[model samples]
Target: MTNRSTAIPQLSWSDVCGRRLDRHGLSAPVRDGTPADAVAAMCGAHAQVLSAAEVSIGLRVAGATRADVADALWRERSLVKTFGPRGTVHLLPTRELPLWTGALSAIPPSSTTMPADARLTPDQTDEVIAAVAAALADAELTIDELSTEVVARTSPWAADPVVPAFGGRWPRWRQAMHLAAHRGALCFGPNRGRKVTYTSPRRWLPGLQPAPAADALAGLVRRYLHAYGPATPQQFAQWLSAPRRWATELFDSLASELEEVEVDGSPAWVRAGDTEPPPTPPHGVQLLPYFDAYTVGCHPRNRLFPGPAAQRALAGGQAGNFPVLLIDGTVAGVWHQRRSRRSLDVTVEPLTPLTVAERRELDDRVERLGQILEEKPQLTIGTVLVGGHA
Candidate 1:
């Protein structure tokens, strides 16, 4: 731990970016040769959009393909897909699920978000959570099947409509499924045809158990600082989908293990002894997929994706709309891709002109993307809409 009287270092935007890139395993190719290493490096890969998660991991791990990621999840059991930080689907290393589950469960659920007509009583919620764990203990079941079991074990409340979505009603008790995942009780299994399935983590990973909530939360905060440090309490709260006051309290509790730092004039915290100047910026051009962890992990959106870059890279302030062109750890442009039987055409629109070297590096990264998808490359450079929508 750093001494209390240690002078805090002020980091430039470039320095912050350099350290983040290195920590995320993007400064150079990941030499570990395992998908779990890349996922673990970023804490976990954002997996709300499945294909985007595949591309995000493939870009960091050398020689990794989309199929390789799938194999690790389904066949190898080295990775598990579950609702993680911020209540979003994420691909987490199987061995680390306990820590994530315990930390996430520590956050009390918000009653404001629950619909009055479909809200479950506190006792009912507990019943549904237990039912979900039991129903999935030794079997893989689709949401429909699991819902049936939950209703049978709990009450009719589990099947009642909570709200309207996607031209259909969402049941109130479905919230328990999310809770079960956060409790380390359940995780996603392979798809059956077009339907998704859920299974018990205990069945999939024998002897797996969650650590104490306080210890797990501290560990999670330390890991977050390592990957996206110099972060404010609000930023940490946003990442975890918890209240700012809750996050601030958690941050204060860990002060003994953390040190203050300045980022672009804003005061933030990082792990103790991590106040050293960041390394020189890495040189390269890369395409980051939609919902990429690197893009989502960095905060203070105005700086990392400023003005036009933000408008193009993000949709209505959301960061997962389009694939982004990253130049020296900053968002410089946006891109989209279309695939044909014989070739893949990637359209790129740079907010500003790139240097000759940057353009060459861009091409190299494009070729690498092609290899990961098992498709031939065809480059098209121009302005394109977010998500490639017309």
Candidate 2:
């Protein structure tokens, strides 16, 4: 049973949004913060579309640019790109890798079953991972190079091209790539021309090791609550794409540190010290790019994507497929951007009528976006004809 009490604190949707946005650096952005600061605030930036991830972090830091983010990843080494939440490419703070690696490795495996011919058996998985770790320990290697090493180190079955991906088959050994990542055996290295490379975290972070699992997961839970609280274990599970039962038990293990609260009459939680209500709901316009941490992980989806937003901005009830327009903490519209040379063509379709001031704010925000992206932005206030993930 949960450590819930009758005296649970009550919060409205606005209260929840206000506090959450504040913690995410959305309500009051940080002018002095670095990309790492912004990245840690959002847990990590989803980077399937690296440029979009740059924008997501850049906008949260005043005067930050894509150059700054690139420097952090490649030069300063403050950020590490790896398979993160939901096993997607994400830019996580390097210093936090121990927490990330430990927690990720400890997660219960996904419930979805892969096809027999496409998946690795338990022994093969371990063998492939060991081969991967050995191959990347001292040098960076591309997936092809790693595959070659795996095939050499293991049996030819490790090289069997049986898994369908992106219209072609990937070698069976590639299936263990993420597993190797979670086990702290691999992470992204600098790109060679257009090809990606992988290196051992040991080589990259030197003397790096995952934190103890229980400690790391507890810290991750606390951090998640700090940013996205008045949230439930189910919501946390969705964010990490972790097993629901595992998430529930993890939260249960932290009952002493968490304070149960009531949000919009529904049960939720927050860090024990964060029981007080936040200042106020944020005002003005927010243009969030695809797969933004806020859009992807926020709870009470119906409220964030109220009415038309649910139909327009979300793909099958999942957010992050479309760039969103948030006004006063709720999704007010959808937007799209197309890059042209050094300029961006921005299209916005507002589901609600904007006041003259809101329109002006939007124009300023678009200009601000151009500043962050080092582009010239042209805004169209009418229809966004493009579909999601455009």
State which candidate has the highest TM-score.
Answer: 2
Candidate 2, 196-285: lDDT as tens digits = 999987765888889999999999998899888989999999999988999999998888888888888898988875877777766768
Candidate 1 whole-model C-alpha lDDT, 0 to 1: 0.84
Across 1-390, the per-residue lDDT of candidate 1 in tens digits comes to 333596667887888888888877777878776898889889899887787888889988988988999988988888899999878889999988889888889986754665565677778878888898889898999988998888899877678887566888878787676788998778998899999999988765797788799999999999999988878888988887789988999988988988988887888889987876656775568899887888888877887798789877877776656788998888999988878895889988999998999989889988988888888988878877545321
Backbone Cα, N, C clashes tallied per candidate:
0, 0
What is each predicted model's overall lDDT from 0 to 1? 0.84, 0.88
Q: How many Å off is the CA of 35 in candidate 1?
A: 0.7
| lDDT, residue 261, model 1 | 83
Displacement of residue 329 (Cα, Å) in model 2 is: 1.4
**Candidate 2, lDDT over the whole model:** 0.88
